[model samples]
Target: MPAVNSQPRRARSGNRRDEAARVAVLHAADDLLVEHGFGALTVEAIARRAGVAKQTIYRWWPSKVEILLDTLIEDTAKRLPVPTELPTASGIRAYLRDFADFLAADPAGKCLLTLLAEAQHDPGTAASFHERYLEPRRIAEIEMLTRATEAGEVSPVLGPEATMDALLGPIVYCALTGVAVPRDLVDTLAENILRPRA
Candidate 1:
């Protein structure tokens, strides 16, 4: 007789129940963060709101910060997707507008601010936030700029890093400072940074 395998089965990636629990946990974390702020956000609270065991939350995410990071990534991807079909300048403008709106909107905007604040004190959080969240978006924006340069739609005078800073800095500053992002900021940024080939 063959020896019985005594190890417990690991959850499959495509398991429906696992996916549902994941989504529930993410949603619960976002809702709780918005409702009670990060100070009150805990693994226990997330588990309760998600209707899952505390151990389940721990099984997937080690801590509340990880859960919030996941929530932020999902929300940013959904709300501020990069424009693919438009011309580079137009795409940048559209993206900037979306970004501004995202910073102003509830839940996601709040989530971003919360993470940024949390990152200030904890080196581990800061590193993970940069590596996991900010770097991907930065790379995507740089690719957009590269395409525009290759197409001769815009001058390549500004380096990719400078261009991103110019386009994103003001709106993010406004968001952090609690000031309203100007209505014409996107247009101004696009026109200036993505100046037409002359």
Candidate 2:
């Protein structure tokens, strides 16, 4: 007969405490980045803000950049959900809406912009970001675009990469240049990307 519980039981209380501390540290890091920007973020500050020891943070993440990147990943995963089954223009619209909402509502948006800037000027940071965070999501998005193109949801001529660039460029541009994206830009982007070319 098979055992009712196949896995070994662990110390639930210890694990919960660890998770709570970890979450506090991540949230504190995110809040600091948003409130003070990247330059002002530090492990000591995160510890104080999170009400944890500095060593606790360093135990999990080696550096401040790693903590910030991890926070960004966690925030994106929570906020900007991409549909995994089928990629439709409508699904893209939904994803875009969620992304826009995150930018408007969450501090992670500031962290994202800061990482993008670091990627531009700092190679080590860029390497870590691409290897750990950006590239995997990028590949997934491109695959999503491929499915969208195949389903006649977007223009095949531009293919996945170009279409993705077009759709993403405006959001980044508006963010970086201080121009506001229209309230309906989510719908506008979905329509423009999916509409037939002349």
Best by lDDT: 1
Please name the candidate that would achieve the greatest TM-score relative to the true structure: 1
Candidate 2, poorest ten consecutive residues by summed lDDT: 10-19
lDDT of 2 by residue, 34-70 (tens): 8888888899999999999887777778888888898
Local accuracy of candidate 1 as per-residue lDDT tens digits, 38-82: 999999998999999998788777788889899999988887776
Tell me the TM-score of each prediction against the true structure: 0.86, 0.83
Misplaced by over 4 Å in model 1 are: 1-17
**What TM-score should be assigned to candidate 1?**
0.86
